[model samples]
Target: MKKNILGLLIVSLLLVFVAVNLLTGNEAAPASSLEIQQAESKVEEETVKVNTEVNAEIPYAKDFTLSNLQGEEVSLSDYKGQIVILNFWATWCPPCKEEMPHMQSFYEKQDDIEIVAVNLTSMDVGLEKVKQFVDDYGLTFPVLLDEEDIVGQQYGIITIPTTYIIDQEGRVFQEIVGAVDEQMLEEMINALKSYDE
Candidate 1:
């Protein structure tokens, strides 16, 4: 059932991409096989904001505190004035690793959005392993360790790479269930930023 939903989400995103291209007159003059492939990949890479389009049922993101890599305590409400990407992931997940670099890029590129990477500590090998992973990946964003998995349980994070894009009001604007790309992250942030302005 989850697989079916994910597939549907991808297809929906592709349709949105084509629609945007057509509206903006950004598509190629003559649609070739290469153009078709580019359109699909470009749309997938840019990603689409959800919840309204397909009516994805995501709860209001509740506030929680967790310790970052440096042992400093951080809370979700701490970023009250900014958009936040609350990503739940584990070091062991391949898709998590694949999308993390893009997440890092998004974090670095945007000053208005905060990316707090919550590590499923109980599921990961150890704190040392997480540290090594962070170092190896050059992740500069807040790498939080969910030591007790309490926040994970509260969020009902049954899958790795589950992400919540919270608005300035701390509302869950979108819930992404899979890995996210840099372009997608940029688009979401921009879309929300526009709403605030």
Candidate 2:
């Protein structure tokens, strides 16, 4: 009887050990997954905060004198009394291409608005390519080339396809990153007009 009782105790101890390990392993998997999700959420939140702060801080237009496709000097000071749409774009970017038509439309609809599409400096490409792109897209607005990228650097442009709406007073009213629609452009224009009045 004593030997039988000792054997039963040994089997019970083995079962308890296995059960404890299984429970701990299951708990650990869920804990790890939760940690990963929390980290992702934090990163997303931080990115949104940074973008908002940057947009709010850089809300004014800076003056620049750059050469146009025709090799003529153009100055932002020339457009001081007009609302200017300063767009920074690259020829290869798809979003930039998409926004071109909308910008053209906006330019056509408004007389007071001045649209200047500044092409970033490119050595891999030449002036002919940019001219061809403008011709193909039917962009009637003056497309300037920042061959030295000086204007880009002065504006702190870290990304392509950036659009800045500058009011008649030369203050930057809005900064848009990536592609934007015609309606958004109209809204901004209207707001600037109201401010001017």
Q: What is the TM-score of each candidate against the true structure?
A: 0.73, 0.69
Once fitted onto the true fold, the runs of candidate 1 whose alpha carbons sit more than 4 angstroms away are 1-59
Residue 153, candidate 2: Cα error in Å is: 0.7
Error of 2 at 16 (Å): 22
Per-residue lDDT value at 144 in model 2: 83
What is candidate 1's lDDT per residue for 1-197, written digit by digit as tens?
99999999999999999999999998657789998999997776555634323234535579999999999999999999788999999989999999998998778877787899999998899999999999999999888899999999999999889998898888787788989888777777776666656
Candidate 1: pairs in clash: none
What's the lDDT for all of these models? 0.85, 0.81
Q: Give the C-alpha miss distance for residue 84 in model 2, angstroms.
A: 0.5
lDDT of 2 by residue, 108-127 (tens): 99888999899996531778
Model 1: which ten-residue window has the lowest total lDDT? 49-58
